[model samples]
Structure formats: structure tokens, C-alpha cells
Target: MTRHLPSRRQALLAGLALAAAGCAPLPRAGTASASSRQLPQERVRAAAPFPMPDISVPDFSASRRFPITDFGAAQGDQQKTSAAIAQAIAAAHAAGSGVVVVPEGVWPTAKIHLKSNVNLHVAKGATLLFSERPDDYLPAVMTTWEGLECYNYSPLVYAYGCDNVAITGEGTLKAKLDVWKVWYARPKPHMDALVALYHLAAKRVPVEQRQMAVGQANLRPQFVQFNRCRNVLVEDVSIVDSPFWVLHPYLSRDVVIRRVKVRAHGHNNDGVDPEMSQNVLVEDCVFDQGDDAISVKSGRDQDAWRLNVPSRNIIMRNCRVKNGHQLMAIGSELSGGVENVFVDNCHFDNAGSGARSTINNILFVKTNERRGGYVKNIHVSNVSATRIAGGVLSVETDVLYQWRDLVPTYERRLTPIEGLHVSNVKVDEAAFVCRIQGEAEMPVKDVSLRGVTVAKVLEAPVSTVNVQGFVHAA
Candidate 1:
């Protein structure tokens, strides 16, 4: 059984009292639905059994701490601090294992490249404020943009081919977003560049030759990325503002992100994106995002098929979402299969400012015919929400946003999705209970819902097309 938290009523009372006393208060963290809190585990088990990896926090108690002050970094200088951090990382690498410390001050810097067996620890009063100039991330490195691999700007914090890495301590990692906010709009040049990159990937061009960041591509790099690494941990950090998706783990394994709070309201600011990875866990996190709170993805079309990796064995629990498009979302770019995802014991608080105040969806799984993938054995249970704009559960296979007219579909391939289970989910208000649409040739199948209750629903109870073997009870 999932452990339930305090009710929304209690949280609301606390907030009101704090407001009366002229103190800022947190939004309500709701409790699990009473109808589903005692759901049986067997009803939500996977179709086939698989082994879960043992993921844990790294131990750095015995390692030496290398402070950046020892390497000529001042509190207000960007160039000197950036070079000093690189030197500290090199020193830690030479020492086999160590923690590079950023002491209590506002340190302005450029891109930080991480090495193996090193922890970038920002102390309690420290803040790493990244530069706003796009050229600071110039001389493109090997990275991916929207599921396609290319050479682009380096991420703010990047780790490539490393192991046993971490970013911990009670401080903030922020972005100076003067340039990135303007780059959000998709103009003609950006569209043309996207089309060019897609054709390049489809023709199996070398990653070196598939260079982005040319002719107004505007592919923003992630805030922090771990590419082709293993055994990672990111804990106890407050990330406020990002260039793109925050905390992305791509092509990695055995990752854990716990007790991390993120508030990124810029465009494409997903709190955490686990792409083409395996054996991950995210727990005890608080998110206030512009996009999905947590989005699970595999990869894009031909590139994903060539790489042939599936994201599996992921779990999320005890998380609180203040505002987002969805509390949890699956890909529109999942050509590489996704499976064995379990989410439980979470709260979605959708109390926002004006008439647009609500979460778009509680849970959403989106794809299109051009995305050829397989999704199986996804289970969500024991969740509660308030003020949802869309639906409690939504599965659509025609979500082509800008690519609909930007690039023509080279090959039409439908995804096969099955074995989805949801139980003990309750919502105070929503547009619909479920809105599911699938392809006619290959319909979504084997879905089960039990003990789902809603106080008020504006739209239909369930809206579906091309779905089979669906069962709903009580």
C-alpha cells in the first residue's frame, strides 16, 4: 500500500493562516486519493518480471575538498572563475576522487565540464550564475537536439563518458536568460534549420558533419546533462532558471535524483528528462515548471532505431508539483521503446493566478504515426490532483507540434502501446476522465483503470478511439 500524506484541506488552512500573518506559504501538497490509496500491488505489476538496478548516493566523506578559491576564482568575475573551475576539475581528476567546492558567494561562470569521480559541491550560500551570451558556449560539442544527434553548444554542466559523478549541497544553479528567452520563438530560419538536421540524421550522416548552431538553429542546450555515463547522483540542489530541459540523463544508467527542487518557467523547461536511459529513480522532489514536471523519452526516428536503446525500470514517488503542463508525460519522440515505468504517491497542485490557472493534464502519453516505438507496462497509482484543465489520463498518437508543416514525414510508422494500468487516482476537478486516441491499423490495447474518482468533470467521462481490451471498474 502506498503511504498517504495529509489532505488538501489541512494544507490550505496552513497556507491561509500564513497569509494572514504576512508570511509566504507553500502551495498545498495534497494527499493520495482515498479510493485508491490501498490498491493491491499485483493489479499494477508488469507483464514480465525484470531486475531493477541498485542505485544509491555516492560516498565522498573520505575524499578531499578542493575549494575554487585556491585556484584564483573571484566572486564576481566570469572569465577568471570559469578557468578556475576547469583547473579544479583537472586537479580532482588527477587525485582519482575528490569534491570541487564552490564557496559562499555569487560566482559568475561559463560552461563547466565535469570529469569522472568528481562531485561539484556548491555550498549553502553559493550560487553559480551562468553567462547569458550564446557565444560563451561556442565551438560546438557533440550533443543532441530534440532527439537528433549533432554538434552544438555545450550544456552549462556537462559530463561525457564518466562514472560515479554528482552535483550536491544546498545551493542554487541559475541561468542569466536574456538571450535564451528571445530564442524561444520558432521563426523561419529555425524551422529551416530543423528540417536540415532531420534530413541529415535520416541519411545517417556522421555526427561531426551534422553540426547545428548555424544559421539561426537556436537549439538551446540543457542546464545539466550526463551523456554516456553511469552511476550518477544529483541531490539537495535548488535549480532556478534553465536554458532548456533541466537535469537530463541521456544514454546513462543507475541514476538517482532526490530532494532536488526546480523552478524553471522558461520555454521547454521540463524539470527532469530521462532519455534513452535505464534504472532511474526520482523521489522527494518539488517542481514548478513551464512544461512537464517529469518527461520520459527514448529518442527520435532513424537515430533511435540505429542506436537501439530502450528506457526502462524507472520509478518516481513522493513528488510535489506546483504548476506544469502535466505532472508526468511520455514522449512525442519515442522511437526507441519505453517500458516498466511506475509512478505513485505524488501530489499535483494546480492553484495558479488567473483564468488559465490549472495543470493541462495529470498524466499524458503522446506520440504520432511518424514515431515508431513500443510502450508497455506503465503503471500509475495513488495520486491526487486539484484543478486540472485537460484530463486525468490522456494517450494520443497524433501530437505533431511544429513538425507537422516544417518537415514532411519520410516514413509513416505507428507505435504499439499496451499494458497500461491506473488505480487509486482522484481529482477534484478536470475536463475529462480519459481522452485516448490511437491509430486504426495498430490500436492501443490492454488498459485497465480501477477506483478512479473525480468530484467534478466538465467533459466526457471517457473519450476514446481505436482502443481495445479496456477495462474500468468502480
Candidate 2:
């Protein structure tokens, strides 16, 4: 039933097959003009050596010119603990120095606003406990979600619009264990303090002179959110009990998140949501979460329809994902598109019950019917998965999660997906569903598997494939 459907894109992409062998070196900051900033063909660029792609650990161990603090201050003066830490950050950022060490024991604070160009390293036994009181996280900061301008509740450890940042060492960055996800998806009356402050900040009121709206206890609080930053690194930190999403990197570039551990029981608490970024590397991380682990997004359907920016050039290698909905996702919110990505050398291990747990795998693309954008040029390889609730691999152009009979059209869909490759993958057990489904008319191209092995399958049915060469385990 293959018909020669002629179209503008089919004609163009007829010659634009993904024979893309290598990647050209990343351009220096000032190389490309605003007009030629991004190459359209760059979308097909194969996974090449980014040559230490924009992340490195520069010996923050010995360069501890910054003073250290012990939160075990015998005097219960919150001001002393607060002032000493604030001065340390200011001094560290001022001196172009590194390491404001939070070494051992619990350091409780109302709000500890992080600064630019500094590393907050915590020792193995140390814990930075943030005050549950919402008033501490005041002074509305500049941030964005889905690239829209709005006064949203920011993170506990907030850094919006900075560069060369990090949070290193093995310890716990603890938020109030019981607060949970109080106000992220919805607004509350008590959150008027944060809202009013944002309203005032939006009105261009002076920060110091703005009225302090208090006694409110509602606002979406992420454990850590670094927005619109570059060359960022988050390494070797164990985070627990976040109020909302654990680590959110929104609208950033050239970021590396390594060896971080996240365990939380809050809803929508994804380990990392890399929204609208380029050249991102998330490796060697362990996530046991409440919602989808490390889901990637450009924006939700409607908002994403307008701001059609893709999450491109992403690599998640050597990571372990357990207790989460599909280890790596093209997204539920794929308004723009996701292209040229790879998730290799990862493991999926888990028990049973967490809100995020599901058919975890290396690749899970489900944007059916209400398609906002496309997911193209994806690869998953060298992975071993066990005890998955769903399938080893799945691709959907329509959703079975909720409503049906709604076909997302051209005006709705942002882009098209093509060029998918999977190799050297093994799945021990899938107790439920696993399959691939694209729009009957617009079949996904270049989808293949070279040494995939699967067993103990139960739910779902799969059939149609458009790839040229595909091999499956017997």
C-alpha cells in the first residue's frame, strides 16, 4: 500500500538521507552570525567526537580559597549561619575563586540563593537542609518554563542566567522531606506572597524596597533549577525529598550532569528535565523518582506549537535509570522537535512501586494523535534492562494513555521524525506492553535494530516498520 506521496519535504529529504558521517568541530562563541547561527543540515550530523564537549572538572579540590562553615553553630542564631554563608559566596564569586565548602552536618537555612561562577561542594556526611517556610525563597527571580515569561515559583537552590557553575561532592542536598510537591501545577491562595512579590518585580519595583508579602505557604519549589545557563556541571550529589522536580535545567546550553543521585517521593519529580537545550551530556547518574526519569522536552503542545525550539544534540550515556517512566524520552511535550540524539551504555534496574516506574528503556517516543513536533535521528545501544513494566522499545504517533480519535495535523505537529537506530540491546522481562506505531500515512523512517534480544513479553501488538535493514534476536 506504499503510495508515492509527493510533498515539499519528501522531495527535499529525498536527497537529505542521514549519510552524515561526522560532526564538524563546535564553533567558538563568536563564530556564527545571528543569521547563520544554526545549520539546518546540522540536524542530521552523526554522533561525533565533540572533543570534551564543553564540560570538565578543573581541580576544585585543592583550590579551596573560600572559607568553610560548620552549621553546628552552638548559638541557634539563624542570622549568623546565613550571613557567614552569604559572605562566603560573595567572596568566592568576587575573587574568581572556587569551592564554598559545606562540610558535614546539617546546615539549615531559610533561603540560600546560589551565585554565578562558584562550586558548592558538600562533604560525604554533610547535608544542606532548606527551610520549608516559603518566605525564605522570596525576592522573585528571573526564570522561564517552556520559554514563556511568567512569575513561576522558582527552585530552592536557584541560579537563573549564569555560566560556568557546579555543585560537586558526595552528600545530601535536602529539602523539607514532608512538604512534597505542594504548588507546582496549581496556584494556591497562601502562595500570594510569592505571587505578589513576582507581580511587584514584574512592575519594576525596586528589589530591596519591594514589600515583603508573607505568611503564604504555596509555590512550586524545585530542589535545584538552573535556567538559561551554559557550561554547567552538577556532579556527585545525593538529593532527597524535593518539593517538586528534583533537578531542572531549562533553556541551557553545553551542560554536563555527572554522577548525581536523586531519590524522592513527590509527584512530577523528574530527575532532570532538559528543556530547549543543545549539546547536553547526562552520564553516570542514578535516579529513583516519583515521575518520569530524565524526560526531555521543548514545551507542551500549545505553548510548544508557538515556540518551536528543539532539544537537539543530547547524549545520555553510562547512566542507570530505575523506578521511572522510560529512562530517556523524546517527550510528552514535544512541541518543537528532538533530533540527533543517543542513549548508550545505560542500565535499567528496579523493584516495583514508584510513581515514575513504567516500561523503562533507552528510547520511548510516544506522541500520538496530538503530535506537536517530531523526534528524529535517535539511537539506543549497548543497554541491559531488567524488570521493566512496559516494553524494551516503543514508538507511537498516537497515544493510548487517554482520549482517542483526535489526529494532530500539520498545523499542530511541529516537525517530522526519521532516522532511528537501535543496537546491542537486551531486555529480560516486559510484563506488559511493547511496540512501535507511527501515523499510518507518515511512517517513521530509518528505524532499525542490529542485535536486540527480548523475552517474556505480554501486552501490546507491533507490526509496521519502514527501515531498510533490521535484525532481531530469535
Number of the predicted model whose TM-score against the real structure is largest: 1
Question: Candidate 2, after superposition: displacement of residue 342 in Å?
Answer: 1.5
Cα error, residue 68 of model 1, in Å, equals 0.8
Write the residue-wise lDDT of candidate 1 on 186-287 in tens digits. Answer: 677877888999999888776667888776888898999988666678889999889899989998776888899998888899998899888788889998
Error of 1 at 276 (Å): 0.4
- lDDT against the true structure, per candidate, is 0.81, 0.62
Cand. 2 Cα-lDDT: 0.62
Give stretches of model 2 more than 4 Å off: 1-64, 68-79, 144-149, 181-219, 301-308, 351-362, 368-371, 399-411, 431-434, 460-474
lDDT of 2 by residue, 246-341 (tens): 877776666778899888767667888887777788888987876767787775554454445688778888888767777877776676677767
lDDT of 1: 0.81
Write out the backbone clash pairs for model 1. 36-424
- Which RMSD values do the candidates have, in order? 13.9, 10.9
Mark the 10 consecutive residues where model 1 has the least summed lDDT: 35-44
